[model samples]
Target: MKNIKFLIAGILFGIILSKTQVVSWYRIYEMFKFQSFHMYGVIGSAVLIGIVIIQLFKKGIIKDYLGNQINVKDKKKGFIRTLVGGSIFGLGWALSGACPGPMYVLIGQGALSVIIVLFGAMIGAFIYGVLSKKLPN
Candidate 1:
């Protein structure tokens, strides 16, 4: 029953993403290019709502997922690490015109060319996993 609920939730999310056109590469590219605010607006609104919820729940005022309290801890990384990671991520997004989520959507939409991006993503993830222990925590 839990697995069925999870599957149904995933399907519902995919349907909503498709219906909202949020999975469109053109929409993502437009947001990246700053030619359209639609995608950013949606994301920003989500962030805002999340922030409000977290704040209200932080005092043990609300239950969390699985009825546990959120840790409310901030994980800090070095500035250099943040800059380097952001630059690499931005370059990939710019080049592909699709972020990870949209890349999967593109594949589902029958864009065979997206396989190259997916392959690269998989390789990148593998390399990251291999190097992760060597990198600072």
Candidate 2:
């Protein structure tokens, strides 16, 4: 029953993402190039809402997300790791013209070419998983 509910929710979410025109490569490209603010506008609004919700929950006005208290904790990492990881992620986003979240949407919309991007992303994740322990703090 839980899996069924999750599957239905996922399907609905994918449909909405597609209907919003967020799954298109052209739209993603425009966002990365700053030629369009459509996607960013949505992202900005979501961030604002998230901040408000988090603040309210922190104040004990609202219990949410399974009643677990939320706290902001910065990851400890060296400057080099941060810089290198960010650069790589940015390069991939620029080259693919799609951020990670939208990549799944693109795939759902029949963009088989995204498989290559997915492969690269998986490899990058694997590398990070392997090297995270050895990376300087």
Candidate 3:
């Protein structure tokens, strides 16, 4: 029964994404093409929410859903690695017309064609997991 809540939440989230048109491929294309601000506005709002949540975690004012204290840790900084990763991620997003989050939502919204994107993402993740130890930290 505990997992039912998560299932409901996911359904609600998928509905919100559909109603907001965030799952639209054209919206993503417009964002990549710099032809519209709609997608940017949506992304900026999410960033703001994430910032607020991180700040709460940093201040010890928020806990996980399981009631454990949130711990924010500083990780090693690698500017070149970050730039490379961001470039690759952006390229993939532009090519696929869907980022990681919206990929499943697209499938849920009857975009069966995006199955290829999802499959590619899974394979990429598997490759990353296999290669992560050999890559820089």
Candidate 4:
């Protein structure tokens, strides 16, 4: 019941991603190669929208879908951790031509090949979960 709405929304999002060719591996490759601006435009638009949404949430100008107040908190900055994590993420995306979000969308679009990437992601997450307590905050 309540979760059905999210399921529908996810389906809609997947459709949009497919129609826009945002889930295409070639587009992602082009983005990394600087041979096309199409994916950059898409990413920039998303970032702008995210900034606006975050600002609205922080200002109490908008609430979540369920009507709860949105609280934006600033976490302690970890520059080294951020740099290392981002580097690893970028390397993985470059190698796989897909990030986690688009990986699922690609799977939804019948890209069974992306299952390997998803499996690796799950393994990485499991390792992180197992070692998080021993890692830095």
Candidate with best TM-score: 3
Q: Give lDDT tens digits, candidate 2, residues 22-132.
A: 777787788888999998987798799989987787687777446866665545757887798889988988898777777787787788899889888989899989998
RMSD of each: 2.5, 2.7, 1.2, 1.4
| lDDT of every model, 2 decimals | 0.80, 0.80, 0.89, 0.90
lDDT measured at residue 76 in model 1 versus the true structure, 0 to 100? 81
**Per-candidate TM-score against the hidden true structure:** 0.78, 0.77, 0.93, 0.91
Q: Model 4 lDDT vs. the true structure?
A: 0.90
Which parts of model 4 are misplaced by more than 4 Å?
none
User: What lDDT is obtained when candidate 2 is compared to the true structure?
Assistant: 0.80
- Which segments of model 3 are wrong by more than 4 Å? none
lDDT of 4 at 89: 86
- Candidate 4, 107: how far from true, in Å? 1.5
lDDT of 3 by residue, 1-115 (tens): 9789889998898888889999888998889889999999999999999999999998989988788997898778999889988998899998988988788899987889999
TM-score, candidate number 3: 0.93
Displacement of residue 88 (Cα, Å) in model 1 is 1.4
> What local lDDT score does residue 31 receive in model 4, on the 0 to 100 scale?
94
In model 2, the runs with Cα more than 4 Å from the true position are 60-83
Better of 1 and 2 by TM-score: 1
Ranking by TM-score: 3, 4, 1, 2
